[model samples]
Target: MSDNLQNDNVVIESPEPVDTTLPMVIYALYLASIVTGGLTALVGVVIAYVYRGKGPEWLDQHYRYQVRTFWIGLLYFCLSGVLMFVLIGFVLWLVAVVWLVIRCVKGFKGLQEKRSPENVDTWLV
Candidate 1:
């Protein structure tokens, strides 16, 4: 009786497909921004603006990540230049780059695995 009642009005709706490319695009823009600030940051901004309407929370998260990366890189770069030791800043910068790369790859893998959001730190960034 209970089983019949539960099935009588059940409705199924298709899930919306998530776009995975946006994150990759953001990561590429982030790398470019690091290599060439100002211009590259502008390029990143343009990309973000163009794709702002795309689906899924991941896109927004990636956009935020790219913007954060750009500002942090710029700040540390200027500070490093002024400080003159330079190597420390450069090393820190390299670490950030490597971390992002690793994170991007892991993000792809996570998408493939259909993992949960709590697993974000596995990407290492």
Candidate 2:
């Protein structure tokens, strides 16, 4: 009876796998950011900050990567807008578009594979 009681009291605890929704939302936000010309990324940024600490190790990388992408992309766009006066904004804008596409594609692909980006901490892709 004592052995039975001991066995009953023993608990096996295991951590749950990271939720998939965060990465999907991040990916969607990237798409929306591209479509809206960096407008909706602000909302994405907010989500990133709000849930930054709630995720586990792997998911935290996505959050950081997303936050960096939004801010850097926004800064690039703003600079490009001002450079429009010098006939250079067009080129910068094109670069921003390409950068955004690459980031989103890479992020989505990573999530699809159930892996974090190779270097989520870097500004470059």
Best by TM-score: 2
Query: Model 2: how far is 109 from its true place, Å?
Result: 1.6
Query: Which predicted model would earn the best lDDT?
Result: 2
lDDT of 1 by residue, 5-122 (tens): 9999799888877766665666566656656654665676577666655656654555554555555656655665655574686766666667655655654565555542234333
Candidate 2 ranges with C-alpha deviation above 4 Å: 1-14
In candidate 1, what residue range of length 10 has the lowest lDDT sum?
A: 115-124
Off by over 4 Å in 1: 1-11, 34-38, 49-54, 85-96, 99-124
lDDT of 2 by residue, 1-125 (tens): 99999999998889876677866787688778777866678878888888876776667777778888888888888999999999999999899888887888888888777787667877767
Compared with the true structure, all predictions reach lDDT values of 0.58, 0.81
Scored against the true structure, residue 106 in model 2 reaches a CA lDDT of: 88
Model 2 misses residue 103 by how many Å? Answer: 0.9
